[model samples]
Target: MTVLVPGIEGRSACTEERLLIVGLGLIGGSLAAALRSSGFNGQIVACDPNADEVALGKEMGLIDSGGTELAELLENVSMAVLAVPVLAMESVMKTLAGSLSAAAPNVVITDVGSTKATVRECAEAVFGCVPSNMVLGHPIAGSEKSGVSAANPSLYLNHKVILTPEPDVLLDALVRVKTLWQACGAEVLQMSVERHDQVLARTSHLPHLLAFSLVDTLARQDERLDIFRYAAGGFRDFTRIAGSDPVMWRDIFIANRDAVLSSLDDFEAGLARLRQAIECGDSDALIATFDRASHARHYFDTLLNKTSYQAEYHMQPHGKVTYRVRPGGQAQGRLRVPGDKSMSHRSIMLGALAEGVTEVKGFLEGEDSLATLQAFREMGVAIEGPHQGRVTIHGVGMHGLKPPAGPLYVGNSGTAMRLFAGLLAGQAFDSELTGDESLTKRPMGRVADPLRLMGVAIDTAEGGRPPLKIHGGAALKGIDYDMPMASAQVKSCLLLAGMYAEGETRVREPAPTRDHTERMLNGFGYPVSREGDTCWLQGGGKLTAGTIDVPSDISSATFFLVAAAITPGADITLEHVGINPTRIGVINILTLMGADLTLENEREVGGEPVADIRIRYAPLNGIDIPVEQVPLAIDEFPALFIAAANARGTTRLRGAEELRVKESDRIQAMADGLATLGVEHTVVEDGIDIIGNGNDQVPSYGGGRIDSLGDHRIAMAFAIAALRAGDDIIIEDCANVATSFPDFVALVQRIGMSINVGGDNV
Candidate 1:
């Protein structure tokens, strides 16, 4: 018994194949509209019990032909999309099985059901087993309006569509389903049926259930009209989903009963804990809960923005990003860079180990600092905020850290990996530290060897590289160690481990390095003393909670500082900048070169000094960078090279073999980039000599493409190099700029720089 309603008498065939969409509601009609908008080279048709809906589909051009019977729509259908309600899937599949027996044996079948396990069960029941041609998917997007009249072609744009294809499903069927979503401009993903259900129950279903319950409860009250009238925007926004179709939601809830109940149970338990805290006036406990949630949201937002891939699920990879810059733009403005990266890292690490809640302001929300924050959260510390550079950490106290679920992955941060080694070695549970590709190749022997001397059983990759596995439960006794090299990271690692060791731990450096760790330790009520060439701390002292105001990172400020220093008539002031004595080598080097640099409003905050740095264009003569200043300005050397390139004479740098071990071989990386720009430079194993042409009226160098090899500093260094270039400069692999300065492009643009950033990530 078949009936066909033909209305395609005047239509031109799009292709030999056809697509049939069953159930012409919002989901079905939207799919048809999206396909038609994409100019799909195939016929589209639909089926619905309502004849009016079928008429509407034809008039709207969503479908060329339609019928009221499922049996009539099986004519040459290459693919069938069943967009039925969750509870109605069973009856529709039975009809499909009875009708599609021999009509289209090779036709691909898919469903847009909100609940997968139930729809999958229906398919299995009707076909005696789940069909290999069937794919189940759910779109995580929609509008408040429903029906064919409200079909939106852009509903799936910039949203996610998750497909749950069984392992034994046909490859061709899955491909067709994937293609359909991709054509609609969706970011498609795949996962198991059980996982999809579990995630949706907590994230989507539970929230909707709460909204419905809350709305119903308020509506039944005696003062319902007043309550509704006085409700704020937050309440209305949260409860908006309660207006969805009641019958459909009821069926979805029934189908997903187990997961929904489990999620509700967890939510209720948390609510009970909050209730208890309120009744008992436990301000600390309440702050701990609220702060953790607020900061975690901010942290995840950062992850999503830096993403060019599956960032919503926290699975973004460090892929290729490039920056293109045009020659010559004025660097004139008052800018405040991101917080000091070194202090930002220490804030999270020390905050987690302190005794009480720690309040932090001006935390850097960059990739490196975020990696450090995530590491502490993994160890079970409750941290909150970073909403506008403010964070609250609920410290777990000394000797209170739990074991992390897996290896700590510190992306593109050698400082994080090396410092984590010492901090983790003191834990009661064993731990392993790991990092991205760039960090895996850097030397870790300096920190590992020194930590081992204090009775830490450490295992490392060949020649002392990560992944470093530090064995815990060892009897750690402090020792006086003399370091062969002066590295702030190495120094910080040993100092952090000293807190867990027995007796006094003394570290003597051959030269001075940034002492933020010692200074921060003292600020936290743990005593650390420094002599002329040595610093020592007594082991086994506890850290107390304290407030920290992180100043602007001088490393990031150096780019703009150099920009103003080299360009004629350019004046810029950087606000609230960190002027740590040990870390001002860049300023010292620039001052020595006679750049017009000024430090204004000098003061101290927390344990660090802050100032407003003003720098203007001045004639410069290059001098041999002092060997003693090598350790002080190690990171700033890359940008200083650009300053060297514009100076009046040759600028020489030596005794900086440490540059070879940075994010890249910064020494050779800078040399290569300089060579690409036609700037004269001589490279050696340790350092380089660059000849500067100090004629402000003409270009110092000609620009060409330079590969940064994913080093943030190197990429940023050459970006400012365009200010003095004769042509456009295209710097490749600049994505790591987010690791340090997330707003480098926008901030530079705001201050009148001709830079364009392009990358292949979300």
Candidate 2:
């Protein structure tokens, strides 16, 4: 028996074609809401098994009518949309098929599932219909959250809707689905179900699976309890997807088992090769692999909207004091580094240069990075962050950044400021750049002076402070700039400005900096030449649209490396980490300190080197840190400090004055904090010397209090130090850890480290 739920009686006559949507979760409710908002005058009835969800959808007017029973609702609908779990789709389709057979004018069916082939097959078997009328559709839209409560009407606006229709499917039915999707402000694309699954397995499914598996494994480990104490921005991002709906992912994994399995196998193979290379200490193999990966990331950056994507952070506290290094412990399972941060930043920036709206998945949306996006918005970039760290950048073209009416505020990101300075220096309009307190204190002279030499006028406070005012519209000429410091930011700035210079721009560094800028420029159809330690870029090169696959960041992989190196009997594997020569100094330094590190599965990702590293905790001996490695391991020193403190001999670090200008006075902060823990360490103007004896003999400070100084790195560093302390360590003003790693505490706790909030113990 069929029952009809009448439309609003007097408001408007109900169109005979009604669409019934099941599951009033974010995607389901959003579909209904978008349909109505997009001028669909047709009736939209929605149903959810949960009574409260249906009630809320109805109350919120997101649906014309809502209910808990699918059979009752299916009776009157002309078409049905299944927006539930992939595993649940078969049963729901079966119910719809039965109801459609009971009525006349058989209902057209469609589904919004992430994986297509399985869903299409399931639909065919369950509905007993030629697959044409049952369209397997994925809106490629969502957030990290779930439930109807999180639904919003604008979810699909200008997003992609991929349709996988079988050969026997009705063309008319496909057109209707496409039209409906278009009405909801989405562009439609057609692909074979198999291809869709394969591509997404690498681009989407694998990343999520890695994040979940990593967190799950950590949570089940005895060592996980201590992760919260030392986790930083990288771990938070790599494991963020762990917080997603477990049932949903479990279903996705089951449905796309074969493809997911294949992808994992490929990843495993790649990781294994890297492990072999590291074990043999093959520098050539290591450098080649890293170079390839670095190049690929740079190429991928040009296709992304750099301004829209932001970095994220997490912080946690642990009760345990004193870090222990034990040999042969169970290894942390292999982890693919988090989605590339450098690529994430460049994706949003370059995506903004695209002709149409560029949709991006795997974009990081952490707080400190979001500040960069906001700054871009202030500069006239049209960018939006809709649930799940995803972003859409409406590009304005390569030379389209409009001069900001006021100062552009970049918060706590040295990467953003330095790169943007180069881009802005070549622009035609004047702009002022500012930042949060931490950012303001960072050194800008390295980048500023070079741009000034290129005819760009930049005015800063004493010592090239923040609130920098750039006077643009000047005719610039390239210069043969010799880099005094091995700083990537400075080098990148000059190269970025060179893009608009009058002649070839040459930059020579005594030691190499990260070559992301050079590799990316080449990928963008620019002629960028690298000879020894010098890189040259010419002014006139056209950048075209291309697909990019970003490799994992090694900087982000350092935490796991440290974790495995310092935790006794622990072995950990990190997969697909970018081992660019400029960034591999950390690995080199740690290796010199007697850490047992192995690289495996060496391969190229978009021209950069990538591999999996397997590390085992071993008896470590400290050594003198070379001046050349300082710039290479600048961002990694705090962790290095922790490692040094736990090693067997004196560790001397010199030629690292750059630390004084970071988020906090990193060197000073680390020195003071170490002193508080009763560790003997000397702080020089340019470096620090730590004396270690491979024993946890240091007594705790009576107060058990440590200050973060509002620096994320400092906070995370001290927390790791707490592992080796005699008593509970209380880190005060530790909130800034959210700038990079927000899930630090939870991930660590899951592994077995006892961490608590607002207390002296744990």
Candidate 3:
């Protein structure tokens, strides 16, 4: 009764031992053809009741042998593929079980059933229990045509095949089943039996049933021919699955009756609501429903990769997302924001330019920093991820990088383009840097002009704009240049180019900016000296790789710092925040405004001072922000403006003209938003003066829509304003928040802010 087969080593690697397909229909025939195409030279025996079907399969060479008896095929078969209809599978399973005994049992059986529960139950009944060798799987792919004649060899390519295995299923059996599906170009996924059935009922079974019913009902009409003839492409597409095999679908509906019925009831309830809306002529209700459905439809198309939308425009129809934020919530508990974006960008750049491997921790995974990481990868440098704020960059050393195949795209990162300009200028190969719409409009002439002055050939768009093209192999000589303004980005740019210049390059700034670049360069074993506002570095120096521990961005921490300072009874601690002297203007300004802010647990992390900043609710009195702190807190002004709006008396700020050329015109954008919220404000070219409501308890913060102008900080600032707003504030164009704080929405909601996405999900 027991049949023995050859062992694994006895067969060639290119061949399966023995495979028996129980049904020679479309699925079974396709499996045979796919296996043969994949170099499985094993014997493929098929069984079909129709003689003609078996003869056609043999003629097509889909199967080497054919028969109508399942008993004969079971002997010496290594695996059995049950591709039969649900009703016929029970008898076939019983026959296969009766043909095999426990003496030499090694065959692994699997089914390609659309539904799993019923077929698994039949297997258990025949074998006294579901066999450990049986693995239940369903391919989430199909075709309208049926039979061996219509079989396609590439039917399962790029399609998902889900397996529902029991807890005690044999591991070897599962592995073999997965390998077979993968060999046919199917991505196999595993889940529980109950979950698989429940998911398929909603996603697949219900849709098929609706298609069949709708097509059948329409065909019964008196004008059926005319209706179909005049039908548009949409109607034909909706009813396309109605042409599937009737018997197969009928069995699926019966076998999955419980889940299918539950889904049908839920769908019918929604359909009744739609019907009522039409009967009562509710225009507003109809529009709201259609809008929600349209959004979902577009999102689904994007998931399926069937849409023509660009990456930037994928989040919203017009690249805008409005967050409806309600007032009154105090920030509480300890939180650490994302890693410092500036440090993150520099780590990748310097690490790529250094010698040997450079391991980094506390790297920012935000979009802007990630864009810089991807740019280096576009060049010939090998870099590992920002996996949980850690990155491993295998350094290519100075003059070791290959020319990029095409233009390097740094999305929404001005720091990347400017710094890359200097770094690429030293390279012997030509390079071009481009960015998203926002970065392309930013002024890059500052970096380009300075590089050109150093005897480097550089070109830019009209008016010193982006798409910076750096000509290769230019002899460069270092020179001492006094920066027209204080910009850490511009200073770092020339410093990087100076590394390969003919002599020492010294950059003097009028005002101080973030010193992350200088500190990180030192950490990389590259020596430099700083005197007051001037920093000098020598040319022809090699950087040895080292570790970098980037602290949490103080710029991102400013939002929560302002949030707690403005809201009543609020107390929150920002842990491990960077307190660099150049970037601590926000801390100084908030403290000067009479906020109950304190720094504790101060220590250094990777050459930057970091501490847990604790802030409690305190009445804030406005004052003229020190002109010296302008460059230091430049990036935090958007959030700082909200704090100014809530403080008593008027807060005057000056000497911040540098904010104009950022991701957006920060001053004007914030001014427009504050005006909508009933805040009194005056905007000058270099500064803004806001007259607060004079009541710290309840400021005159009203509800209105604020456009972020594609700026991440602006969007987050208004979201925090809801803490003191009288009503809901809608902030638009907030999708760019990923450039800095990707977790802004989740973190704010966790801290008790009544935020809703599109008037839902409170």
Candidate 4:
């Protein structure tokens, strides 16, 4: 016991500890080389049946010492890494089970096997049960090359290493194993053995099998020589893994057999369907598959990069998007923001519940809107063509929706979540609605309490926050309820559930909210009536499909409107924006503040008012904003606050308690951001009073770093605020901007804003 292995004479090895890597091959040798490069002070050694490979590892200076006998190499080892092939793990675990007793008392054993279940089973069989020191692991990095000579130190750099440790595993052992991989420059993560096997079998094992199969299938043809000679980059790239050591791949496939077979079955079914499409000449089918995959690939890229719609849904930590706007840029061009987000969400929901195909134009392809679309697709609806702001939905009729496989993720849309809660309440299957962190914190009690009164069973977090679990098959009866506040989401929730209720449902708002749901419901042949403050719709009514043309969002255009309003001679025109009376609070407030704003080309499209707003810069004199206008322009206050900062006198706002519950507390978020930019503003309980430093000749405010509180409106508001700032304005936590205006920065830059948008995902 306590054997001392010899190393190269000149190298000083640490006697206090040792790290032994079994099977001196590419993976094991790379681990040693990376440790050596990372300046690991412990003695590095290895064990392999191949004597030549052991000698070569020492000669390459990858290991201080190595030997052919694992038993001889075990003494003084603080940790043992088994990098052997999958099928060979049983015998290796047997050797370890017998020999590990001679090593350090707290010695931990981990493996770099491709499949975890088999390895774990092998350990249990050998050690009578899995030892507390065992931390099952797999490094999601490797090469086609084999043996010790192909060792590359940078192989695992930035790659992921997953450790599948059981709950009964020792904490110290798990931490040490995680530390080892981290030291080798791998991003270490933890998961269960079952999940590891399932994921790896599909992502890694299945791909390799296909690569080998594809290459072999093509190589067997008579034109194989010509095929090989004419191969393109894609062919070579796809088949590169076929060049990997055959025996190793054989074991991986055998070890991860069940999950791989399941994945292969799914792949085969899809491939057969595609083959049938080719034979039948179905262009629509072809386009659907190709288009879905094309967008999905881009969507997945955005998910990884943390840039677009899926990013908010994923909420990854590596990237935080930020915006830096240089002072004083012209706001001089004609622009149109994306389609109204409220309408976009309603289109998808009603379309899915309608009886026939519904065609939609000008769909907002932002994260929040897409979350609505994807949720319908999850519930077994056939949807197509969100390409170029067009969507065709093959509706599944009311009461026809299949239950979603799991909870629906609504990115950052409180609108979608609330609306879904009402719609799902009458379904025959239970469902849940979930959202991102920002959406989760906002009040769902406003929607849940009303839906519950309609005889639906639902549950929310401690403060009535998401994720909302709605138990289906409830006998809903409509109720006449007056809302505490004017909220479009709450009203829409009750109205939607009313579709399945037994009698008439009436909702009275304290003030008006966006009426897209009501307008679109009637447009779809579902009768809804409004009398005074109450809107009523009877239950047991049907929704028939209709074409919808969504107008541009005024909420998004407010930022540009405010930019032009604050800067002298900065005349800008926003084209075809929705001027829905209920949503024009920003326009009303700005006009009352004395900005020379006019509407041109006013017309009605699909029952919603649309107009081109041309605002010419004129000196703004701030006034007391009326209480009646607060609900109409609730979303635009952040941008209006910037305009207030540049007005001639003080602007006082009141009766805006609703602003306290937006994605961020609009009152406080704008106030804090304004304070950073050296603007004078006083925060009251429900509203704010901003003192203006209006000047056509000089900057109205001095810029500084401002946190957007991860609110999209706050981010875009400050981005435009830079138009009147004396210095550069840097806005942080701006990624959620994708949820509303995915192209805000690009559109602004096109209209002459000097802004640099950069961050982890941007």
Candidate 1 structure quality by residue, lDDT tens digits, 736-759? 787888778877887778987666
Query: lDDT for each of the candidates?
Result: 0.86, 0.72, 0.85, 0.86
What is the descending TM-score order? 4, 1, 3, 2
Answer with 1 or 2, whichever has the higher TM-score. 1
User: TM-score of each candidate?
Assistant: 0.82, 0.55, 0.61, 0.91
Order candidates by lDDT, high to low.
4, 1, 3, 2
Q: Residue-pair clashes per candidate, as listed?
A: 5, 78, 0, 0
lDDT of 4 by residue, 1-762 (tens): 122232222113222347989999999999998888877888888999999999999899998888988888888788889999989999988787777765555567889998899998898789877887788999999999999999999999999999999788776677677777777889989898899888888788888999999999999999999999999999999889889999998898888889999989988987998899899996545655665565556554654555655453334323587788899888898988899999999998999899988999999988888878777776777788687899998777898898876888787898899899999988989999988778889888988898889999999998999999999988999999999988888899999999999999999998888898899998999999999999999999999998999999999999989988988878899999999999999999999988899999999998899999999898999899999999999889989988999999999999998889889898998999899989898999999999999988898889889989999999999999888889988999987888898778789998888887777323
What are the clashing pairs of model 1? 291-384, 295-385, 307-762, 308-761, 308-762
Residue 275's lDDT within candidate 2 is 93
Candidate with the larger TM-score of 1 and 4: 4
| Residue ranges of candidate 4 with Cα displaced over 4 Å | 1-17, 221-236, 265-292, 300-307, 310-318, 759-762
Instruction: Assess candidate 1 and give its lDDT.
Output: 0.86
Candidates in order: C-alpha RMSD to true structure: 6.1, 20.5, 23.9, 4.2
Kindly report which residue stretches of model 3 are placed more than 4 angstroms away from their true locations once superposed: 1-319, 694-696, 758-762
Q: Supply the global lDDT for candidate 4.
A: 0.86
The parts of candidate 1 lying over 4 Å away from their true place are: 1-17, 305-339, 356-396, 399-486, 501-512, 529-539, 547-552, 564-581, 591-628, 652-665, 684-686, 703-712, 727-762
Scored by TM-score, the top model is 4
lDDT by residue (tens digit), candidate 2, 1-762: 122322222212223458888888989988877777766788888888899888888888878787888888876566778899998888887776676766524566788998887787776687555355677889888777888778777888878899988877766567667777777778789999999999888878899998887887888888887975688999997777777788888888889999999999999987887899899985534544554354325322322422111211122332222222111223356555454566666666656554556566545555445556665665556665534556666656667778765787666678878888888887789988887667787778888898989999998878888878889898889999999878887888888888789989999998767887677656555678989989998885555544445566566567667766777767778777778777888899999999999989998765667788889888678899977777788888988887887888889999888788888888899888777766778889999999874753342222256677877777666665554556766676655555565555544454345556543333
